[model samples]
Target: MIDVRAVNYTLQVAGRPLHILKNVSLQTKPSEVVAIVGPSGSGKTSLLMLLAGLERVTSGSLAVNGADLTALGEDDLARFRRHTMGIVFQSFHLIPSLSAIDNVGLALEIAAPELSQSQVREQASAALAAVGLAERLEHRPTALSGGEQQRVGLARAMVANPPLLLADEPTGNLDQKTGAMVIELMFNLARERGTAVVLITHDAALAARADRVLTMTQGELVEAAVTH
Candidate 1:
């Protein structure tokens, strides 16, 4: 679940404030898939960052999974994200030096410190296997194809079973076929887990697949259409 009300985000550029998000309000329910389609610099990704607590809102309110993101301190925000949010980025954002399994396990180790090494490995293996990466668990990022690497990234994000998933151009770097596979995997996994998803993408057809489609322009959420 996510709730945002008239949220405004401003960034400092050359000592002057540049408005990024203006009067943005949105909500997502559990197991609901909402897609945000917008041009570059329209604040779609900024909104996702705000929802993830990676950036603080300049005004108004923002909450995800019942936590007031604007009110949390840095440490609390980090902890909240580790426990309640799963984010996938277009760039994959995998550590080059870490194996696929290690990368996924790191998330568990951070979020659930009480888990033993065997437990972490077991869970990470399962996550990777779910993404069709069981055979590549020990391979590093360089050893995998773009799709495989993205799958690994997906595995890492979902390893914690977070209630909310935020994806920013998740399929931007892959070929159409591979991107489709990744998107299907993402949606299916989210459905199975009842996770609320806020997806930021440029693909219209992809956006149309969501339960709702929202369009952003000039830092404002200008249109919202229910697709199903």
Candidate 2:
């Protein structure tokens, strides 16, 4: 449901133009997971931000779920993101002042204020339960473990049932086994929901688990070896 074609992103840093993404082209289809694997400074995260419309593209086209992302004005992109895409960043990005339920409820609240307070509670509770955090709904991020916090993030992202999910280094802070479990749970749930996923990760083994893998080097995207 996502198509990126020959896109390039450039920025000026102290009077020098920095090319962060170069002619990158990739597509993510429903029920598929695409893992982008690259080293630091390889532009994987930059490409994700561009697709999420957090960064402006200097050239080329990007379409997510049929919306032309690069063509929209900043305001339109913000609306699109709220309704169509769910993003999980490296740092959970949870609101410290809000409880876990409120954090996830914020997703639903933005879209549907008509939903009753009890309805919001019910939906938030269901989402947290889905991510194995049913009992921690009342807790804050600081009160939860690293893995639990990420699960809560996933719950928030998936609560609205967005068609596309983008995660950047989601399991970066967890132990190997914990990371694998979180990755597996996230991918499995997304697939079950028929959501397209675009993931950025440095772990090759994690990338290998995806439906397809892409590599970035010096800001250019290259395909990985195809699995038969």
Candidate 3:
């Protein structure tokens, strides 16, 4: 579970402070999917970064799965992320030299250096298969389509089986149908894995699939009504 209270985020630019989030408080339960929908410059990415411990909160109380990220130093935050969280970015951050399977396997290997290469490969292969990318395991990002690359990214995220999954504009680069399928696959796997998902996206239809939809405006959060 995740909880936030009076979350305020600000960035200093040109020697002046610009508020990105204003007293935003939110709580998401385990296995619950929450979509953040907002206009550009509304702090969606800021919120995701705050939750992921990538960006420090200006003023707020926040906790994820009982860890107080605000109090953690860089090393502690890195450890927490390695053990309990995974992120998918709008740009697939795949290493150019590593194939899809190797990329995912490398994540597991980094997390557990003691694991044998064979074990790492097996786990990575399972992750790719779970995301329906078994055949593309040997392909590099440049050799794969956008959807294929993103699926490989999903496999990397899922390989850890972390409790919290944060996706930033996951479908931003794909076609409508491909985006839909990718989003659907993400939600299905998150639910099955009982992973709490905080998805930042601009698509209403994709937001509709979440257990809750939150609208952001001028850095404020307004929880929307979910309709069946």
| lDDT to native, each model | 0.92, 0.88, 0.91
Measured with C-alpha atoms, the lDDT of residue 185 in candidate 3 is: 94
- Location of the lowest summed lDDT over 10 successive residues in candidate 1: 219-228
Model 2 Cα lDDT, one tens digit per residue, 83-110:
8888887789998888899999998877
- Where does candidate 3 clash, by residue pair? none
Off by over 4 Å in 2: none
lDDT of 2 at 79: 88
Candidate 3: misplaced stretches above 4 Å?
Answer: none
Model 1 CA deviation exceeding 4 Å by range: none
Model 2 vs. true fold: TM: 0.96
Instruction: RMSD for all candidates, in order, please.
Output: 1.0, 1.2, 0.9
* Model 1 RMSD in angstroms: 1.0
Q: Candidate 1's residue-wise lDDT over 1-228, tens digit each?
A: 888999999999999999999999998788889999989988898888899898899999998999899889999999999999889999999999999999999988998999999999999999999999989999999999999999999999999999988999999999988998998999999999998898888888888888899999999996566666
Q: Clashing residue pairs in candidate 2, if any?
A: none
Q: Compare candidates 2 and 3 on lDDT and give the better one.
A: 3
Ten residues in a row with the worst lDDT in model 3? 106-115
